[model samples]
Target: VLKGVVYISLSDNMLYKSGSYEMSDQAGETLNKIAKIIKDYSNYDVLIEGNTDNVPITSKNIRNNWDLSALRASSVVQTLQNKYGVDPKRLTAGGRGEYNPIADNSTEAGKIKNRRTQIIITPKLDQFMDLIGKAPEKS
Candidate 1:
């Protein structure tokens, strides 16, 4: 469980080819696992968030690393809904892009690690309540 919500992380290596939204063959098993979990926990909602390195994209198809990241996230969402029969309403896709870097961009290894996507599974309960409950009350 994470952030008061059940989640499973799906990295880029296990997901797509470098700079592409296409799912890799290695991703099949991991994705299948998520699908199975979704089936088991039908009430849970899946939120797919994508991230990327500092390397800016300049391609016509990819305006910047952000677009690439979002494309990847969207692809995963589509796969889950289309292949696993997960309800479309139960899934969401978004991209943080390079705006939110997990590692230093100076090194190739760090960049690789930063260029990844994550899936956060959350229940329908109001998440904001967790924060409000944890706050320190003042007179």
Candidate 2:
């Protein structure tokens, strides 16, 4: 059996429009499949993280990559709760912006790869509390 958290990562291009945070229809379909999986494993909490390329973004709606990323993450969480019936308490949304890059941002291909979203499903740790018992005090 898996011991701890299981993370599911999805790219932003697959979920949203370029320079936008709205979830696309295709994203809905993909999220539906994910929702089914979450339903079966309802004991876990989900953390939706949004990441963006280093390219600067400026718009009336968005202040920067951070705002854009955060909104994207929030949008995913909202979709999971509103459309998929997932409990709101089990969801968290965070934006990493252009800071954490998985690829070289010098190339278009790399930038595309960097703009992404990650869904991390962490199993509740309460089940192991008994095993851990109490920690010894520091010296």
Measured against the true structure, the TM-scores of the candidates, in listed sequence, are 0.84, 0.87
lDDT of 1 by residue, 71-137 (tens): 9999999999888788999899999988887778899988888877887877666654665688688
Off by over 4 Å in 1: 126-139
Clashing pairs in 1: none
Models, CA RMSD each = 2.8, 3.6
Candidate 1 local lDDT, residue 129: 67
Highest TM-score, which number?
Answer: 2
Q: Model 2: how far is 51 from its true place, Å? A: 0.3
lDDT of 2 by residue, 1-139 (tens): 2445567778887899878999887898889988887777788778899999999896788999999999999999999999999998989999999999999999999998899998888766784464246645569
